[model samples]
Target chain A: MALLTAVELTIWVLEGQIPPPIPVPGVKLGLASVVTLAAMAVLGRREAGCILLLRVILGCLFAGSFSAIIFSLAGGVLSWAVMASLIGLFPEKLLWVVSVFGAIGHNAGQLLAAVAVTKTPGLFWYGPALLTSAIVTGAFTGLGAMYLVRALRKYRERRGF
Target chain B: MKRKTVFWLALFAVLAALGAGTYLLRGVAGRRAVVSVDGEPMRTVDLTAAAVPYEFTVETDYGRNTVRVSQGRIAVVDADCPNRDCVKQGTISDGAIPIVCLPHHLVIQIED
Candidate 1:
């Protein structure tokens, strides 16, 4: 079930188009991060990491795009690492910050890959640009998780997690 | 008020200041130029000061391409190229980036 959820998240972002702004490069609905955030809050880092790796590998195979895999893997690993670090440092209530930082981390990882692929350090100038995008998208996704958790907790207590 | 919240928030603020600053600076300088394919240098124009929108077409051994530039931006409004990636690149306003038609090898760069 978790596996299915993660796969669906990846597919939605790739095809989904949000209006006007088009997209800021790699940024998206960040649905995967939603799963990441939920795993951290409900499951644990190890379980979250398992989901993360599975999704990255499966998403890569399904998409059949090695380049996309490289981009997403780097971002996913880095974001997961950031989430783990922040969760350790902060109280449970502060998961939103995890989303923001993870988003930035995701961009940094992707930017690093971009720099490697382009063989251009000038691309590093895009780092901050990508980070700002992470924040907006991250905040939105983070808030999404926040509300989702509130609802899930009620359901879980009734049905048991 | 958690320690991690403080830590992450501070870091994102720095990133935002730097990123938005660069993006806004990019907006201010305003750039427009032209690129060519078939190893030919056609012409370069400063789009910021142009009095009106310009229509341009490139003729290559491959085929012909028609582009439109308006408001200091460029897009391949029409092209005979197999893949219309150039037309789909949309209006490129970023100074550092250029609208490129890979099939036709036409480039529109924004310049100082």
Candidate 2:
């Protein structure tokens, strides 16, 4: 769990440095979610939740912003909950589908946070754009997580860990 | 592909298409730019009437943002937030997307 958390934190921090592929606010690759999903698949939901919580808290600390923590926590918790509930229903091959839903949940949570903080219902206008980006980015991260899960299983079998 | 895979793919495709359509068909170009801080309208600039580009600073409890407005366009050219996402957003002349600075709780949108 600690190792997974560290990897996720690193990805979250590094991903922030890269300019968003889409110029829209709140749209990004969300690459760190790959680790969270993989951990949930391999380790279990509780472990995955731990890793995700640690990553969000630590990532915010590294960024040194109080407001950011609120957004990250809202997104992280919602995404984790959605993935955790869907993880078992879908087979490994269909992990990407589960990921897409989780990504949507993440964006919804962040949008809600933004609205609540700013008290601006107008922010909802960005919802469609966010939803579109989440689906696209979610599929990519989900595929990455699926491969990571498979590779880890193979490695464990070979090494007998 | 498997039936389950196909079903999921179709579902996502429909959702993506719907989202994309709504985003693309927001509205025609807008000439009035409304700048809001903490959900309160701080300023409304008439981009169509402004022949000369002008700038103003909005300072709130969160931080500060420097907004630039010109004919038919508006943008946050500067901000003291850590990310500067509002500034990086460049400018907007339509209602498709608003310039948002999450840290400073600022939003600028072009409306008809």
Candidate 3:
């Protein structure tokens, strides 16, 4: 759990340093979700949630932004819930689909937070763009997590854990 | 294909289509630009009526952004915010997307 949390934090911070590929606000690759997804597949939903919660809290502290915590928590929790509910229903081969759903949930949650924070209904104008970016980024991170999960399974088997 | 795969694929196609539909349909041709800060109306300008291009600055606790306006369009040309995502967004002639400076809690939406 500790190691996974660290990995997630590192990726989250590293990704933050990179400018978004496009000029859209709130659109990100969310590469840290790769670790969360792998944990969900390998370590179970509860463990994954723990890692996600820790990573989000500590990440916000390290980043030194109080407002960021609300957005991160909102996005992270919704994404985790979506993935947890769908993981067992979908075969391992379809983890990308699960990831895509989680991404949509994440974006929706953040949109709600943005709306509430700004008290602006007009911000909903960005919804379509956010959803489109979520699908693209989610597919990329989902494939990454799938490979990570497979590698970890082999490693665990070799170590007889 | 398996039922699950087929179902997901169909769902993805529908969602993609919906997103595209929303994108193409959300643009408003109105020449008015409404600028708001933290939900409060900051400024409103009719882009079509502006005889000369002008710029204005919005200062807030979050940050500052300079918005530029001209005939038929609006944009954030400069901002002190770190990301500068708003500046890079260039301009919006329609309501399809607002010029959002998240750090500044600022939004410039063009509407009729």
Candidate of highest lDDT: 2
- The worst-scoring run of ten residues by lDDT in candidate 1 chain A lies at A17-26
Interface RMSD of 3: 2.4
Model 2: per-residue Cα lDDT over A36-141, one tens digit each: 9999999899999999999988998898877888999999999999999999999889999989999999999999998998889988988987898889999999
lDDT by residue (tens digit), candidate 1, A1-161: 48535654665546433432544433465776787777677767888788787877776676454556676788899998998888787565676777888988888887776556434444565566676778877877888778766776787799885
List model 3 lDDT by residue over B1-112, tens digit each. 3888788778877777788678778766667989998889899988998679999888888878888888898889998755576787787888777776666778788887
Summarize candidate 3's per-residue lDDT along A8-90 as a digit string, tens digits: 99999998888788655557888999999999999999999999999989998887766677878999999999999999998
lDDT of 1 at A88: 81
Chain A accuracy of model 2 expressed as TM-score: 0.96
Clashes in model 1: which pairs? B32-B111
Per-candidate TM-score, first chain only? Answer: 0.85, 0.96, 0.96
What C-alpha lDDT does candidate 3 achieve relative to the native structure?
0.85
TM-score for candidate 1 (chain B) = 0.64
Q: Give the lDDT of residue B23 in candidate 3.
A: 73
lDDT of 1 at A36: 72
Query: TM-score per candidate, in order?
Result: 0.69, 0.95, 0.85
